[model samples]
Target chain A: MRIAFIIIAIVFVALTIAFTILPMGTIALIPVALAFLFSFFAFFKSKERKRIFSKWLMFFVFVLFLVIVAKDVFVKDKVVTDQKFQLEKQNSQQEAQKELEELEGLK
Target chain B: MKKILTIGVFLSFIRICTGQISPNETLIFDGSYELSGMMTNIAQVTMQTSVMKTTNKSYLHLSAEVATFNKWDSFFKIRDLYESYVDPGTLKPSLYKRNVYEGGYTKTEKYSYNPAGNSIKSESKRKNNPVVKNTVSIQPGAVDVITLIYKLRSANLSGLKAGQSIPYIIVFDEKQLRVNLKMLGKEIVSAGNLGKRECYKLSISANTNKLKGADKNLIWLTTDSKHIPCLIKFSIPVGVGQLSLLKTAGI
Candidate 1:
């Protein structure tokens, strides 16, 4: 059980680096969530509860990582989509104005 | 015999380097570009253009892999591909298609031009969205973005003055945009591995809000019958992106 937790923790750190350096988008969230589960096991099921400072530390780190990933997946994505919508709206307005100017030139 | 062999090799080398584009022949351009902002490289861009021999169609493909040097990765990895089937006799596009991917968003569009009706029927499909159908009016000889690049190659610009501007229309993303190309005279510019060459300097301005407060996009085309696009510089929301021709083939 301890070995499994150590392995998951290592995978979690590697995925964090990968997510930071690459445009993996929501794909990065899968590993982050899995790490969170492993951290929970480390905190509760580890045999060396008295000397398990590293397990508790990893648990907190995984929690923080989960928050960041959730914010990116839920909040940042929505903001980007909103900005694109606004840009499209502005473009349509400009197109209409240009058409009006052309009509006036013809008249 | 030695002299003849040397001359033949030299002629072939020239042909390979310049890829002398002719009206009746096809040409291909393969190149890479760099996008930078705030004095830092932000992305690597790859571009390829080829003319299909079987269908006589011209295709341009561009992809950008955004870097994560800023700690946070870019939200988008962009890919844009355009294909146009040109009428060999008229050099005008009869059909056009565009496939675009930016981050998680994707859209595919097909346009059919009807010269008889002076209109174009556009069909676009977005991810998880209903298909969009629209018909837009077009001017005579109006082309799409991809076709416009090739059309300008075959166009006669000898009569254009240094400060003169030519008006053209292009249909893109369901919008018929009026674009003006202003001649900024001719100058010698670097052509990467090809070294320096004389090129026609031109600036593009379009009737759109997206270009507000941005410098007009600049283009340098070779001042020859080939009329290859040697260099292009355009401003993005952040800074600028430059696309330069790196090599040519199949001319």
Candidate 2:
């Protein structure tokens, strides 16, 4: 029984490091797999307090990672295109009105 | 402690991901919206832009006094016909890059006019220096030569208002100003790193006689007053680029 527990702990350590270090968008999936594994193990070993502890811990980590990944994906992407020539066009027309009014009033 | 820290990091990431709130809901009338945006067909540079909308007209304006002054050498290296400077009278293309005063005024404006207000004139200029891409390009307001442009008039920015797309062919001051512009409908676009925003994306096109792609202009204006142009993609064979409005104007 102790050997089985030791192997599980070793696997957990390996998985945790992979989850943290893989980089890119895939890191988000780590906690979820960890959570599922822990939860499945707890279902089979319901009487063990260690199983409950691991299960809850892994689930919490999963939720947190999911949030982080979603944040990165949803950030805004935008740019500016200055409309100088357009402004010149519109304003020049308005300026023409003022110029014409000035000329007419002068007359 | 390790588990706690790991969870904490992920939680922080989530906060960042979901923190993108929409633009604020205040100030939702009908006028142009300015965005903290920039474009670079040359290199990675940001420019300021403004987009305006009325019942019958819409337009975008973009400019970077710094970019116009500091010509990118890398950009010149790529394009064959596109050099930093060219001969004025002959319009001959040349790679001769000239340095000018590094700053000047940048302005953009759009308006609605009756048919009687067609001719464009009455230009003001900076006393000594001018805002020319090249010193030899042309003096600001020197000849009062009106260049080519596309016209826009629309309601709610979902493409040009129904029945308002004119193949605008006008002869003003002996210059043939012809344009073919069409709107590309509405889209939900991101305005900032904050969140997604719904906007009307208008495609701008300018036909060229003096220049290759002088008749194209693209702009994205918010249907609402978050008043942001979520995205604007212009064109070139002339000089243009893509720009997006802020996704989160605190809305």
Candidate 3:
């Protein structure tokens, strides 16, 4: 059916997009493909006219784009252990400095 | 799948080695503990065999044939002896007297120490001095012999506390064997008469830069404050043999 063809085409496009993204992008794309499939199934079974089905497909495409963006925002975990470690060590150094200052006063 | 399983098994073994013994006390090593879990052929090897040993805290004194292993391509095969020990408990060794009568030459070493097994000092001689070559010296400041009278502070059969790696390297003469060591963790180990005991252990391997291409000794010492060597193992290119602690008790 024409609707089935659209669903398959959308899934292929989503998978192609996943390859260029992060390690987990392949997983993030699954929901988007499913959403496209659901809309296609709805369009085929609906008594509504072609124009109405077109609107539903458009809505799903928009939802898919949002998911991809949300994934990119949440999955990044850029971490700098070196900088954090230095900051922690700084706190200890400050304590040692205070101890030394007190010792100097005693002298 | 295979690699994952191997990693899992290795991790669990580490846990087993660490989880059973608590260091009631710790043996202090100034720079780092020396001697390794892996075998090292000394100037002499003493082969010990015992006929009788109690299950509780007891001691076994036996005589063994000391040996050396020849090596090729990092693999070791037992070779002719460089030196051998008679009584490891005493330094005045009963040497394997050499003779040329049978077109063969064999010699034994001398020395003896504690047979108590409850302390590092009591364990068999790590340094079997056959040639007794000038009590060879090296760093962190060396002297021929360094002896300590170790006291066993505590003993129990609890799974590893926060920090007890079974079969850990307790102590060594950096001046003698001259090898760097490390603590891997603990495990359920068999003792002479104690049936089985969970022990903290330490292991040592030759650092590539330290010594190259020798594979006869794989020393796995227990991690007790006593620094008991529950297992001293050696792998020949074709085979391996082990001296495991059967039972250990307070001295």
**DockQ scores of the candidates:** 0.02, 0.01, 0.01
All candidates in order of lDDT, best leading: 1, 2, 3
Q: What is candidate 1's lDDT per residue for B1-251, written digit by digit as tens?
A: 99999999977654543343343333222222332212222333333343333222332321121222222225444444455655443456656666665666788787777745378778899988998999888877688877677666655566788989888888878788998888889989877556788999888888876553433588888887677677877764555556655554433
- How many residue pairs clash (N, CA or C atoms closer than 3 angstroms) in each of the candidate models, in the order given? 0, 45, 57
Instruction: Write down the TM-score of model 3's second chain.
Output: 0.34
The residue-by-residue lDDT of candidate 2 on B74-164, one tens digit each, is 1221111001111122111111111122223322211212123333221222335453221122212111111111112112234356324
Model 1 spans with C-alpha error above 4 angstroms: A1-107, B1-75, B115-117, B213-215
Better of 1 and 2 by lDDT: 1
Residue-level lDDT tens digits of model 3 in B99-157 = 11111233222222213321211112222333432222223221111111111112232
lDDT (10s digit) by residue, model 3, range A1-107:
65665566466446535522433333445545565655666566656666475455657566655767675566542212234324533443344334323323432
Docking quality tier of model 2? incorrect
TM-score preference between candidates 1 and 3, better one: 1
- Please give the ranking of all candidate structures by TM-score, highest first, separated by commas: 1, 2, 3
